[model samples]
Target: MTLFGTTLDAEQIAALLSLLALLVFWLVVLRRERGYARWFKQWEADRKARREAEQAAEKRGASPDGRKGPWG
Candidate 1:
């Protein structure tokens, strides 16, 4: 309050309130952005697929001795 030896007027107070409202609106829109949601789904799917492949490999008695499994 003493930085410039002056006090804020009514217009300055109103401007601050307007800026706060705009900030909240943009934050909401950013939360609904599709690209962010899509990437999360893609990452989850990839993780699931990898787990399934590993489980299938384990079920076939496949060895890590560089030999192909019977499924091939």
Candidate 2:
């Protein structure tokens, strides 16, 4: 077959298509994984900050619900 003014056999065309598909697949997978990694990092940071805040509140003699009463 002719492609871009170049001749390619059936096997060559098939190999080229396979390589293109693999590249696209990996690109999509890597993009999604990067987003997941970013989200996880942010989640971890927020969790750590919340834990520190809770500990600070406890040190200040405050309950988790912000009430010093026995019910809290």
Candidate 3:
């Protein structure tokens, strides 16, 4: 009953392909962003640790209780 019978619809195939492409693109972008975010968080933590260490060092050389330091 059909002339040159084709079972698939052209519009449906195109739409499916477009959706697949978008899914792949977003996956790649999200993976890269996640890696960068982890790196940034680690960097911030290291910086804070270093600052706290410096402050501790400064305090150690400071006066004991209410007494002045020897170098003061």
Q: Which of the numbered candidates is closest to the native, going by highest lDDT? A: 2
What root-mean-square deviation over C-alphas does model 1 reach?
Answer: 7.0
Among these predicted structures, which one has the highest TM-score? 2
Which runs of model 1 end up more than 4 angstroms from their true locations? Answer: 1-32, 62-72
TM-score of 3: 0.66
Each prediction's whole-model lDDT (CA): 0.82, 0.92, 0.85
Ranking by lDDT: 2, 3, 1
> Model 3 over residues 1-72: C-alpha lDDT tens digits?
222585547776777789999999999999999999999999999999999999999889877774675755
For TM-score, candidate 1 versus 3, the one ahead is 3
Candidate 1 weakest ten by summed lDDT: 1-10
> In model 2, where do residues sit more than 4 Å from their true spots?
62-72
Q: Estimate, for each residue in 17-72, the C-alpha lDDT of model 1 and write its tens digit.
A: 89999999899888778768989999999999999999998867766674785754
After superposition on all CA atoms, what RMSD does each candidate show versus the true structure? 7.0, 5.7, 5.5
